[model samples]
Target: MRGSLGRRELLKGTAGSVALGLTTGARGSVSAAPEAERRRAVVIGSGFGGSITASRLARAGVPVLVLERGIRWPTGPNAETFPHMFSPDRRASWLTPRPVLTGSPPTVWRPYTGVLERVRGVGMDILCGSGVGGGSLVYHGMTIQPSAEHFTRSMPAGLDYERFDRDYYRRVESVLRPNGIPDDLLHAPEYRAVKQFHDHVAREGMAPYRVPLPIDWDFARRELRGEMKPSYTTGDVLYGVNNGGKRTVDVTYLAEAEATGRVEVATLHLVRDIARDSSGRWVVRADHITTDGTVRERKRIVTDALFLGAGSAGTTRLLVKAREKELIPDLPEAVGSNWGNNGDRIFSWTPLGDSPGALQGGPACMGVRDWDNPDGPVTVVHGPVPFPVDLGTTSVIGFGIVRPRGEFRYDPHRDDAVLHWSRSYDAELTDRIRERIRNIVGGSLADHLTNITLDTSAFDTTTFHPLGGATIGEVCDAHGRVLGQRGLYITDGALIPGSTGACNPSMTIAALAERNMDEIVAREVGKVF
Candidate 1:
């Protein structure tokens, strides 16, 4: 879409700034500074993980450059293509098209139609982000941590949970600022359904905890005080909200990091390949996509460190391609193996009467953790919402559980990833849970919660949470250091060991990134670029 700069323009413009700190050799080739002074890290994908990592690195005084494949929004030259789907003032962006599915045991993939089809196989909907903030700009902000029991049980034996909690998890929470919604506010109709579901579980002698969220309560309190209107409560968040609820990485970490002046984020620069120079420095090849439908491949950047925080699918595909091309051999066997979608299942029902606060735009504030059983199938029920309007008549109440039946592997022939997953439990088990939800919703407001089913067909279309692949273990030594690769690291959902029982994944991912960085900073490994 953009034109590649010729050698003449490159010598005096953007490339000149990059070449300032380097030495020019034969044939216009540039070499980086010595190891002692070269202290920059290149982060790909500016979603939750990448954004947070970049911010921390920059704050640490290590110059960090973020290369995002998507166009930057609001201020970038290509911002016009980056549309806000949920904006009340403007129509939605047609970039993300819905899919069409048929039959039982459905095949989950992008549908073959609309603009989404053009980039479908390239990890489109399941892992697509073509703007400044990445998915954080478009995801529903529901952030929850897994229970201690869930984390300990799923983690590999060698990982020290005590060390992990002390080193990484705590720092992550501080930056994310996750908080639990108050019980009283949750008594509203929508959350009442959530509480009722918990009540039913309690009646059955099962213990369920309220879901923790990442919303800014102080801001919400102001909105409730009439000082500010509930901006997020007005609509769905998957398409981006103006000034609403939870603190996305863009509004939080990235914004603050940019103020430091040490960090620079270049959007629309899609990284194509990573190679190591003769001197052991890292070189990145990128393609700058422009709005005019032209593709220009120029600008090779060399840095000392690199962080692969490009989600599971995106990061895994890049690594697999690199391995096949012999760019980086000796990658751990755990590069792209363990993968899980957190056993996502949406159960919908139509409430007979109108429900107040049902259309509120907050991401699920509370959930019934009643089914978080280690010995059996664990389930969590989310509050009802007007978004994703079910059957065109009824509101939808959704729930997801962590299932272990998930794996990620690379398909070199297809140049893509094969995500194989299934319901961790039988239909009968899920059906019983659905019935329990229906009964609870029915009893809570004197309205019937009808049309219940356990459908996997939805995965063929959309997902709010996706996890695993490049999981933690001896292969990476817990802190996400791939055994042999010296300067390479992974800090994304790909490092999640397994499914987080009855929990949303954004908080967990962000938390884990903080932890990984703690290890990196502790070792002083990323200090020299």
Candidate 2:
């Protein structure tokens, strides 16, 4: 196999291809026997945290192995590497019988290792990405850094906001290279909805600033100029971006780690359990599966150091299950505590007057930051839905400060950790967000309909950004080292204390991972690895 497969050159058996250059030994069929392997360090899930951890450790001369549950999604100028939003198939969901998105029809789909996973919980359902790039692949690319005041309030007091803004945040931005949408692109004929949103915010006496997105603006410009396909221009990026522009983790951090020849990323490796061996080393049990959800092989990997970067839900589920099963007997009490949905509320906005064109240029280029609100800070961003015709509808998503009141309990019958959340967990914050949206466009007929009709416009019990559980300062130390477990760590949204100060968690997650890896590489390289 080649050391690195070009993004354009992927296996072509399915609609969504698997790029196996980093996965040197993965198979398509069942193997003769299970495989056993050992590594100096093992990182689970190749999202922002895992990719940063692998890159940093590999640079420090540590050989690392990364396990991802989903297949790679490679893209180029006009590659059909991902499923479109309007015409989704099995490639839109991960082993789900139907599409995960709310408005999607209940069409039964064949099982495949798709990009998105919807983890159903009490009172809410969480949307998590499944592939090598993890959430970065499916996210709207809103790279936001929380303000210092809110950061200090939401996070552990030890994490210096000034230091992160100056150093680690800068590090993440330098690599991701986020940019706001240029004015020329925003004023394009297709982006009428974005302009409408900005005008509404301005009329409501709020400043609508362009959000920094890790996307190549030129790609969108090219689509507008008829040089390529209309992925970004039409906002048809719900599954994954087909025409490569978004700087996802696989192409940035993971690619760099693989280039060092010290990191091996294994895709289609779904981790089932985690425990410690007799010699105090970490033992991971996983299944190597085909894209159709059939297990091809079972594998055991033992490592001196293990980092849980499988996101808030996945990591917390594994830890909680291990704790209950007594596989890892001495886990902390906070392993399943302090879980949250990041105070998420997504609203569908329909204007009364002018119909914003259906072709809304996106990756969510603009937002209104209401940091001064006494009801707790909130950030609302405008996003475009990939509808082919003018529906006069768009989406506005809000994030705010909500106390983490969700927990996971082990279910023996299912042999898994099930999330338990109250319906009233974030009721107050949800109200604030709803009111804020109403005040933004109050006199409109849409607002009147929202007021009279019993609709989900006020609150939707779903979150793309699930935070906390195995949180920092509770389950782990300030530097993400688990207090009771030696050589075990957390380097994902699971480390955040339920929220990212009213902003999306991606930038903070990346920055915090950079900070934690810095301390870890400096202190524990020779001793732990």
Candidate 3:
């Protein structure tokens, strides 16, 4: 969930396969390597998909090298490894002069290797993560499994929801260990807003369900007990939860992969571009940069197997740029097509007479799944604002089923790819969902609401959940194997066909990768790598 500051307050906030030995470089110094380093497997981006791929491949007796563009954020009790929502610094953004918030005014700062990056496209702006754990580092930890009907409706055919629910989905859950908010935590004094949201949902004749979150409630409880600094309980998770209990991919999957002693994760290595050599090997060009964005070393890595898990924006841009530059021949024409914003809409609602309390507890716990609607399925989650003073406000973010109408086009002048989404891309469906929310909060109690403002952070063609571009079935097969390029694969959100039903894409993306890896390892382990 993308957290937004109050609208009246002026808004704010924010790889391959193969096995081989890795080389080392000097810290903060340039390396003059004569030739490209060779490896058996290289996985780009260390989020859910890449981490899972590396873990599975390593378990299958393959040595893996994982490349992450951002530095590692190691968090502990009271550790200030991440930026706070109210006091953002250079560590809050990726390369941008200011935080990539939609409605916030630009405040310049020195560039650094930050956690989040905003890719500004023509009609849409994508907010993606940049650290070792990728999007999981900043996501609200909503690990939702879409219903079978919705899954079938949005995803490409040939995926069996039954199998996914039984196997791959369980695989992800086993690692992330997602669970509902404990009763004690939800009923605590600090979580009055969450309890109020549940009461409101029940009063509106709808049952509120506890959203499954990959978080350790104990850490939050400790904060309440004054054993740690306030993070989750304070709702200061937009940037990240400083007193980390979040089971982000880096701490879960990537950690396990590294523990196997077969995986090496290179941090602060920004991938520039990718191509295939004459001998049919994958060549990845990257720049080893310092925390201040200085390129210390230019590296050329050749691999036998390559997996692209650089999220939707990063993976899409790399493929689109490679295709336009004629670097990778016969690339899929659909490399930059079928992108969607996941029908994301953020609303700040303040009940007329009720105070939802200040210092709302979160990483979201309560939501309503209105899947039975005839028009289209929609899911709404209650978002808690972490403010020190009561503003009589809380937030609700809605996700709806929408067509993938956005496309990414290569911008030769900028030497990059830009998204082209129509202003009215999913207007009807999002409007329908908006009406559903309005009815729930404003219908009979319309006069009882003090205010309801659509946050421009999401309303202004911006999305925290960016899906598609190099989507499955168009650029790759059902198993994530690129159609024309053997040993090349997509194991990230980019493979998702625009939306993961009406749910967030994390669970589905990881499940799909698990399914793909099951086939890839069984069929082409020793043979390919």
Candidate 4:
């Protein structure tokens, strides 16, 4: 808000509401002008949550505006939208000179306020997406539905697990159209990481099975045949697949939503604030950022409803900041509490002496699961990994589950959503998970296998899946309707209370969003919340 061009005053409860009308400005810029209110909705952040919610609503004939803080990642042969994993460009990050990653020190670990961001918090560094497609741009394509038992453990009470599995999860999968790693591709040399792990685990008396991935295998086969530039073959999973094989949100929900012509996707529009106007409509303030990272225009949207689907960090931070700034009173005390790393950790495993091949694949596909162990409740899953720097050696990343939650605090001076977590936050739980990883390595690998290395040693503090804050039955009702606030809803990963068992959290996140939209649409059209 420091450089924003608008009235700084927010909607105080006692004060009358204020409206800013649209006006032509510098370089053909425009501002908000209150007009006849329509039954319009605004969904913030275009990840799985935002995409699904916006798409379904538009399908139901509701005019929707989707505000995404990140740029629209391009596709096709001429598209150079993403950065290389090895030589990461500054554009790979959000307004930073370099890619902000795990093990970042204090100077780089700044509390985030910009709605468009790639941020890290103390002991819990998070890598969230900042583009139209959200984290789908950077995440491993692995998707799994958590076991009903473990899913219930992390989930807040009153969520009917059986119904979700039977209806919601199935509904999401029907659209996602996930497929197991192809039989032919797994035999390829490029997929040595997966094949070797699968074989090794089976030898260890564990029945390792193929996991479902959100990638289009048909396109991958075309790449393997040298008909096009490689995406999966080149290990372009983390930074994004430039060749367009990945079935990201852009290719699915967003594309379908745009086809309806009733939805508008505003990319690079940083949603700065949300408050109520006098008439009880929602005010959405978005900073229109150009390619050069300059704020070109301050655009505000007046809508009948607003959905905070800006992932866990973005949504939590925005709501917390709104409360702290007094823009919204009665913002729940649980707004920033019960958040955690999802027991996510990254450590390496390499062959004892032999070259572990290129150690490059589609970033992730196969992971070792030991969920049946009586010693602990953790899953040490591996991914199709890489040597990032091309060190000629292999590095396999292990993601383990540990159930510890953290909270977000609003710092007015910095105008940041600060997360306070320590390495020792859940020592015992972390140890249990790590030891399981060690056991998997020790019991499975041979003498030549090198033990897992510490690398930054801060690996345990980072999380790709940051869950909670504005969670169910806490900051919001079980249906994601914010308590004490009407005409507002939440549909994103933040609705997840904590971990999603040993699986990647995206599938569960989307499933929950699907269920949220079903309820929201019914309530909006007729049924009450």
Models 1 onward score TM values of 0.73, 0.92, 0.92, 0.87
Model 4 lDDT tens row, 362-434: 6566666666767545655556544544443444444445554688887655566777777766566656666
Better of 1 and 4 by TM-score: 4
Prediction RMSDs, each to the true structure: 8.6, 7.5, 8.3, 5.4
Worst 10 residues of 4 by lDDT: 17-26
Tell me the tens digit of each residue's lDDT in model 2 across 437-518.
Answer: 7777554665566432122523546788888889887899999999889999999998876789999999999999999999
Candidate 4 ranges with C-alpha deviation above 4 Å: 1-8, 11-39, 77-79, 102-117, 388-401, 444-450, 453-460, 526-529
Each candidate: what lDDT?
0.53, 0.82, 0.81, 0.68
- What 10-residue stretch in candidate 2 is worst by lDDT? 6-15
Q: How many Å off is the CA of 359 in candidate 4?
A: 5.5
> What lDDT is reached at residue 168 by model 4?
89
Please estimate how well model 1 matches the true structure, expressed as its whole-model Cα lDDT.
Answer: 0.53
On a 0 to 1 TM-score scale, where does candidate 1 land against the true structure? 0.73
Where is model 3 more than 4 Å wrong at Cα? 1-34, 103-106, 445-459
Please identify which of the two predictions, 2 or 4, would achieve the higher TM-score against the true structure: 2
Best by lDDT: 2
Better of 1 and 2 by TM-score: 2
